[model samples]
Each structure stands twice: as structure tokens, then as C-alpha cells.
Target chain A: MRLTTLQKFLWAAVAVALVAVGAVFLLVDRSPEPIAQAAFRPTFSLPDAGGRLRTPADFEGKHLLVFFGFTNCPDICPTTLAEVAQVMDDLGDQAGKVQPLFISIDPERDREMGLAEYTEAFHPSILGLAGDAAQTRAAADSFRIYYEREANLEALDVYAMSHSPGLYLISPEGDWLGQFTYGTPASEIVADLQARL
Target chain B: MKRIFATLALIAAAGPALACETVTVGPLEVSQAWSRASIGTARPGVVYLTIRNSGTADDALMSITTPAADMPMLHQTVMTDGVASMPHAMEVPVPAEGQVALEPGGYHAMLMELTQVLEEGETFPVTLTFRDAGKVTIPVTIQNIGASEPTCPSPDE
Candidate 1:
């Protein structure tokens, strides 16, 4: 049947509306939903103090508490690590479910021996991890940790490193929980972990 | 007069027994001197204390010397964007009628190239030279590796 020009225009308009509705539905179904911030996870494969490669899969079924610092840090690092030790003490038997990892950003100075001594001084269960320059950078980048070595003055052999201080909490299922800022009380950390666990 | 003399003797004895070791030189009073136990001789260690000046004039901490260490330098830990860096400080100022605290995350004395290891529970001597108060020697108690402050004896005792 021959259609009038107006009738043809109306049919074309109807077809265009149907196509628009179909495109909207396809777009909505194909696009991925936004993920919650807590569920974000960045993986890292780094070396432990014994020069053994460790990955996230190795820590499955346990919550991981990760911190970034150096051994020679006389003040902040030791203070924070002591707080973690206190948290462990506060956790009592439940401490077995939590794994505390100390990641060294200063690979040049902090080696197996130094890391071992430092971590052992704080707690026997706390594991010390360090990687080569490339691996260290990759891990820091993935964890969004900031670190920089200050200028060596007076030609002294010893130098200082500045880094972001915090405790990164990873869930048992390998998801990012949150970060506790510097000087977070041990009681608060223990309570948070208990609630989450 | 006899009672006053007896009271004075008791005060003197009590002063020395206080847990907070303090040395008064001229108008400067230094107290709570402490350092962490070192693992080895070559490793650097830190010393912390509080200095108060009661005199009418300001004083400056010129230098620190300890026989246990080869060289002692004044240093401060500065934190920027979560990074902590220790920079050598020429001198720390102590205002008159004010106090200055050398804490863990702040100013401290960096003992380099120790001649002997500082063992826990042991004490060492550190000589602080002030611009106006001259030099005062104080015993610094060696604390555990992670101790933030020196253990103070309770006042009740």
C-alpha cells in the first residue's frame, strides 16, 4: 500500500523512538556497576625477609595488616610497630586470625638481616618484607604509599627516609578495608578489627 | 633550727631518689634524659630529654658530647606527607622561663659510631653545653628499643 508523506514521517519517528529505547536498555545492561571502595583490591608479589616470594594468595583466610616503613627509623616506625604489638596482645587468642606485615620502603639499607632484627624486636609474629628497587616501587604504587629519601648532608654515610605512615587493613578475602592513620590507638585498632572480623 | 636542718637533709635525700633524673647547672635544669638500647656498636642511637631554663635570659643548646659515642650530633625528625626525615640541627633554643622537649618524633641527639653498645637498664653520661648556662653532665638511662619515654617513679612512693 502506498503511504502518504505525513504517514511515512510518522512511521520513521516511531521507529526512531523504538531504537532509542532499545539503545538505552542495551547501554544500561552492558555497563558495569560501580564497586564499593572497601571491596577494591590491589595485589602484590614481594619478597619476605628470608628472600622468599610472597603473594596475596599466601595470606588467604587471614586478615592482613600492612605497614610501610624502614628499620633505621628510630621513632615513628618503632612506635607504630609497638602499637601493633600491643594490638596483638589485646587481641589475645584472636590474634592468630590477623597477620601483620611490615613492608620496607628502603631497600638500599634495609636487607634481610636488618629487617629480621627490626621486626623481631617488635613481635615474633610480625613478618618483615622488602623488595628490590623496582619491586618496592611497584608495591608502593599499588598500595598508594608515598616515600622519598632526603638529601644526604655532611657526607654522612647514614641518611633518612620519609614515608607515609599508616596501617593498611586487607580483608580475609583479599579486599581493601581501610587505612588507619599514624598514631592510631591500639584499642581503636583492636575494636575495629574485632567488629570487622 | 634543729628541725629545719633535719627537714633539709630529708629533702636532699628525696631529691636524688626521684626517678626523673635531673641536673641543675646555673639556671638550666635538664631532666628525663634517656636513650634506646643499641644492637651494635656502629649503629646510630638517639637520646631524648627535656630542658627548662629558669633564668631571666634565654639559652641555647650548643653541643652534646658522650664518651660512649664517637660523635654526637643534634638532629630533628621532620614529617612531611607522612614521611619522616631527620635533619641535623645546629642548635636548639631554650627560652627563658620556658622549656624545650626532645621527643621521639621531634628533636633528639643522634649518637653516631658508638664505642660500646648501650645495654638496656644501663646508664650513660651525656654532657650538654648551653650558650649561657655552660656545660651540664646528666646520666641518660638506657631504655628498651621501643620505649617512648623514660619510666618515672611514682610520686606516691
Candidate 2:
């Protein structure tokens, strides 16, 4: 059946409205500053694997990829470190300008368990950092990351830690850039970093 | 009969891909049991699987025992406002004629004080005790450290 002129005009208007909605979604997807802008400038002076004190100032001219997790974490921690390894591998030579750090929230246990070996298993480029309880709390507070150690009632001497699940990106100038939520694919993270780099 | 035996032998020999075979226990079917490679030997391990109950009565998973870890128990990863916490679950209910999936980011079997490091492409056995179904042992495949899903091979060979 042939459409009337009025019906045709309505269809055209609907098409335009759909296109407008699509454009809005695209705009929202491109800008990730809603949470990043709200975050404060992150600062921390933690000890690295080699027992040397390192801070954001130490990496004067490189982006920082920081993640906070404990060595004892089974599921999420290793998955994230693997993704960080993928990010570093995909970065190629540009990896030289990026520093990936695995900061231990369970400093006491992680220090004894050897956080260096844990991070090294994922990627050699990633550095493992562990500090005392007070230092770890300060670092987590600076980044607005929350972590709590809960005792496992079923098993004595065993515990689990609950923490914020995400990877933080900091600027070369030590500014809080943004974060990639848990399970964000390595390719998407690479694209975001590529644009910034 | 010969073909069936050959297939079973092939599955046992081909460890990783053929792991997580569906096994029936009473009125419940368990399948897709898998875990990820552990980072450190001292770090705990985890196992995920699915349970489909086909009976008229609901069944619950009571406990799990594995030689790979000294302490094996059921736990759920509860995410509240972006923070993730794991609380021990005494029993995981499997509703009658319904399914329960113990997967990543949800209910799973936690292996505390791992006796052996879980390496990628390796398989370990764990015996799950159900309230009504009694107990059944199943092999759990260890996938890549970042694997989020079980890697089960197709049966059409």
C-alpha cells in the first residue's frame, strides 16, 4: 500500500529522532571523565620489589598503570594482572613510557609471600610494591581505594580481603586520569592509553 | 562397546580439553567444572561449575573435598557498591527442575591452603557432597590465569 504524505512525514521524523539518540550515546561513550574528574590527584611513596622507595615523581615522564590487590586473592587479582600483562604486551615499545604497578593491600602477608614473584609471573615489566599497614592505608586513601581484611570464620589463619576492583590510570604529571573497571578488555584499555600517549 | 571404551580412553588421555565432563548424581547433573591457574603456590585456588536439578525436591551442595587443597569450602563473591567480598556459603541450593551456576563473580568452591599449584592445562579432581545426591567426584580443568569461563570441548568428534 502506498503511504500518505502525513504518514511519510511521521516516518522521517522518527528516523531523525533515532539518529539523535544514537549520537547522544556515542558522545557519552567517548568521554570517560565523569568519574575521573571527580577523583583527586593520586600520590604514594611505596617500596618496590627491590626495597627501594618509589613515588610518582620517580617516573617523571611516563604514564602509571596502578592496581591495588593482595597476593592471596585468587580470582580477581590474577585475572587483572593477566590483563595488565596483555596491556603491556600490546603496548610494544611504547611500554617503555608506561609503568604498571601491582600494589599490595595486604602488605604484611604479601611481603612475606614475596609479591615480586607474583607480579613477575604475569609480566616482567610490572613492579610489585608493598608497604607497611600504615603506608598501605595512606596510599589507598590517597587513591580513594577501599580495602578490608576479613577473617574466614571457617578456617583459622585464613582470611579474605575485599577491595575496590579496577585499574587506575595516572598522568605523567601525577594527575588522576581515570580507571578501567573490572573485566574491561585489554584492547579497549590499550586504545584509551594510545590516545593519551 | 569398543567405541565407547576408546572414547573414554581418549578423554582421559586428552586431559585439559576433555575435562569437566557432565556427570549425573541421583537427580542432579553437574558439569563445566573448571578453575584458573594459580599465581603463587601459597595462594588459594577456586573451582566453578553448574548444577542442574531434575528431581521434584530441591538439593543443596553441602561440602567439597579435594586433595589439591587442605581446606575446601563453598563461597559466594558478593559485590556491593563496587567492592567485592567473599563470604563462606554453608550450602548452595539447587531448586527442583532449576539450575544453579557456580561461576566467577558468583558462587564457587574456594580451595584454601593449596597443597599443589594449579597450572594451566592441568586437571584436578574434587568430590562434591550434596545433601541428597550423596557425593560425586569430577575433574576440574585449570585454564589460563585470566579465564572467566570453562573451556569444554565439543562432543562431536
What is the C-alpha lDDT profile of model 1 across A147-196, one tens digit per residue? 75543222454444557788999998998888888878888999999997
Lowest lDDT 10-mer window, candidate 2 chain B? B1-10
Give residue A89's lDDT in candidate 2 (0 to 100): 81
Residues forming the 10-long window of minimal summed lDDT in candidate 2 chain A = A1-10
The local distance difference test score of each candidate is 0.75, 0.77
lDDT measured at residue A90 in model 2 versus the true structure, 0 to 100:
86
Which is the leading candidate under lDDT?
2
Write candidate 2's Cα lDDT for A1-197 as tens digits.
22244234434433443444455456556865455564468888899877999889998899999999987777678778878888898888899989998889988788888888788877888999998888899999888776765432223444456677789999898888888888898899999999988
Chain B TM-score per candidate, please.
0.83, 0.85
Off by over 4 Å in 2: A1-35, A151-155, B1-18, B54-57, B153-157
| Each model's DockQ score | 0.15, 0.20
Top candidate (DockQ): 2
